[model samples]
Target: MTESKLRDIRWIFILLAAYFALQVGVRLATSHSLDLDEAEQVFRSQWLAAGYGPQPPFYNWLQYTVFQITGVSLAALSVVKNLLLFISYLLYGLTARLVLRDKALVAISTLGLLTIPQMVFEMQRDLTHTVAVFFSASIFFYGFIRSLKQPSLASYLIAGIGIGFGLLAKYNFAILPAAALIAALADARLRPRIFERRLALTAAVALIITLPHLFWLKDNLDFATARTLEKMTASDNASYPMQVAMGVSSLALAVISFAGLTVAVFATVFGKKLRSALAAQSEWTRLLERMMLVFLTGILLLIVFGGAAGIKDRWLVPMLFIVPLYFCLKIEAAGEETDKAFRRFMPIVTVIMIGVPAALYGSVATARFSGHYERLNRPYAGMLEILRKQAEPAAILAGDSLLAGNLRQDIPDIHVLSMDYPGFKPDISGRRPLLLVWLIPHKGENEALPPAMAQWLRANLGVSAPEALVIGVPYVYGRGDDSYRFGYAWVHPPS
Candidate 1:
């Protein structure tokens, strides 16, 4: 590499480091409790299962390893998140360089990724589908690009590993390989490489890595996949028209997220001549444009025609990071100077990137002082402490998955079991004590346990319910006045 090119790459590293440093500070300072999904991820990480619960097992395995090394803490989770994000940014730069010879354009395109909300905010918060898939997809493309350019055994092997791990990360990764195959078939240059021996090697490696999970899925009756599918479609009660409408709206949400950002960035870079800039493009740029469009169309058709009920905002995260990169290519193709956009817009991106995490911390801090109740302000530690004293049980069980999951990671000696999991049939036959806990909206101190919770305790515990113990747990951010009360009932195992 030329000295100039090396310098550009160094700049990319520096900026990424700055972003990561800010993320660490925000994660440490922010007092919000883990979101339900976040807590569940940590809980699932305890065991090295082939598969379990709702998500794939690879994510949990990674977290479990981190837990072993760093011990279980929010900072440890955030460290893993930032590390994966750094990999993502590195891969993005590599992919951009493969197509665009200009190192400046490559750096601009990769850094521009932070401008996407999903890329920055979502990544810092947890190791969710987006973060996992983000790294998986990025790595896959990096190897895919190298394999296409070189077509050597090593390149194909690397590509195969990327595919394997990506799928292991999230089921959604299955879409990416299919899209690439279609792209190759459609493009004459890419089509000839399809029959190469290395491609078969790639497939074999992916299959070998994922085979264990495949068997696990079969043994578990594909319960997680089934549950995921059920959630994607509408309920039987909804009319067909309504389902279609909801699906379409969800589809629009994903599109608008990119559309707004894309238009604004192009307008900022090209001013009124945006149409002209987009109109002119090189052959490679055009090929990639087609491939991305095909990838997106495939996802949309499946969601719309496949009878999906509604689209959650998070479901679109994996592909959304590509939006800024696509725009960067367009801006380059438009014959505009990238240096100008880099100099002008980068500061704005940096501010927003840094400001986002800061804003989150500020919001949480404000809530703590304002005496407002919020999930981010929950007193997870305090709740766990109170429960520890109330019952010495073999396991903890709860109707709410979130509550059980949060406590489970903190108290690893006891299995924190969620009653709501589809396949979790607990063997409560042994004569050991069990503690059942649940949360209610923070009514005043004198409030009684909700009737449903009381009824549940009575039915399951096999005794007249004793007066519930109300333990006040202070919120992470709240003042002395900000606290939540958890009610508990102890159940002994059957004789």
Candidate 2:
């Protein structure tokens, strides 16, 4: 690399470093709020023996790689988190360079990805969304850029590889080809010649990449739908209006997310002069303009509830390049000068990029520490305390539904059992004394065990009906009717 070019890369690295420093410093300084998904990721990853469960294998693959590199410590995971964050930024940088030819505009777009709050946080968590987003951006960037240059076999082959990786990352990634094809078709000047032998090769490459995942799915036929069904039915969704509004905001937010593709899409599609102007531009710029339209349409499809949860906003993160590319196109059209519109939107983007997420997560972290909401998990230390106190070899114990999992984790050899199931009782004829842990204590349920929980406890725990059990209150909480109560601990027999 030339000296000046080396300096430019260094500048990009510094900005990315600053973004990551903020992410980890804030995550550590405030309290650690364990997202259930992240904890479950830790729980699952540790026990992972590869191909043992449902869901695609890539996330486990990525997390396992991180663990191997970092040596299984919390600090190591933190390092891994930052490492993934850096990789996401690097992919965005490459995507920007490919989509926006202007060096300055490309740098700014790179910054835009670096500071996106949703983008930043997604890296810290164990969600598969970031990797999906990375390949999604990659496929869009490489496919159209190649279409412009020479349409060489190698170029199409690379684009095909990107598409395949994207499919592995997310099911939604298939939208890219559909949107790109539609946009290309509309451009009469380009469509006929564009879909030549090379495009067919691209498709073939993607199919080749998708084959392994297809076979894996074939093996876990029931598990795929089973897992999808679980997430779909996980909870009762809210009112229709709220779901609709959420979908709208999530779709619309894509505009502000990185480069505000909405502005570019409107300028190109509805802007009175974009098509005429595009015909006169250099070939590479024309290719980029075509991509902006294609990418923007993909955003619209997402707003249409294209496999969205219809709730989580960051689900749209995979399409980060849309607006940035759009903004860059508009800037290029305006002779690389900062226009009035650019000036107006830039600060808003910056603030929303950094400020919004910090405020939202900051409030959530504060609320958690302040006892504003009920947490489903019991303290690991508290569980350990109870185990040490009860200290008996082969102790027969039962835990609330949640406790059974960690109880086994924290005290493996104990005859730990569940009160959630029917006739699950102590191995009385065995040597361990009986004890119970409520990994999750619900006040109302504990105060008066539900008939199901009560019967299960009585029949399986070797306890008498009703009041014969002495319960120890563990965690405190507020009920639905605005009441405070404790989820108490229980001893099967009131000895």
Could you tally the backbone clashes for each prediction?
A: 2, 6
Q: Write the per-residue lDDT of candidate 1 for residues 65-145, one digit (tens) a residue.
A: 988887777777777778888888887887787667666678777877776665666566554666888888887777777
Backbone clashes counted, model 1: 2
The model with the greatest lDDT is 1
| Each prediction's whole-model lDDT (CA) | 0.71, 0.52
Which stretches of candidate 2 lie above 4 Å from their native place? Answer: 1-6, 46-55, 68-73, 99-101, 114-117, 120-132, 139-161, 181-210, 219-222, 226-312, 339-361, 368-370, 373-378, 385-442, 447-495
Model 1, residue 335: displacement in angstroms? Answer: 2.9
Per-residue error for 260 in candidate 1, Å, reads 2.1
Distance from true location, Cα of 365 in model 2, Å: 5.4
**Minimal lDDT window, size 10, model 1:** 421-430
For 1-495, candidate 2 gives per-residue lDDT tens digits of 246644555667676677666666655553332344344334344443324344455554566677556544334445556665576566556556655545666666666553444554455543444544564455545655555444677767777776776666555566666556665676676676466878888788888877877787777768555664455323347555555565566555544654343444335332544444444454344555565566556555543544333334454554444545545555566454434434544555566558644863565445434656534323443545554674553553343433444444445445455553323344544444455433324444545434555565566555654432333423323223332232333343333
The pairs that clash in candidate 2 are: 259-323, 259-324, 261-323, 425-460, 472-489, 473-488
Give per-residue lDDT, candidate 2, residue 117: 46
The C-alpha TM-scores of every prediction are 0.88, 0.63
Best by TM-score: 1
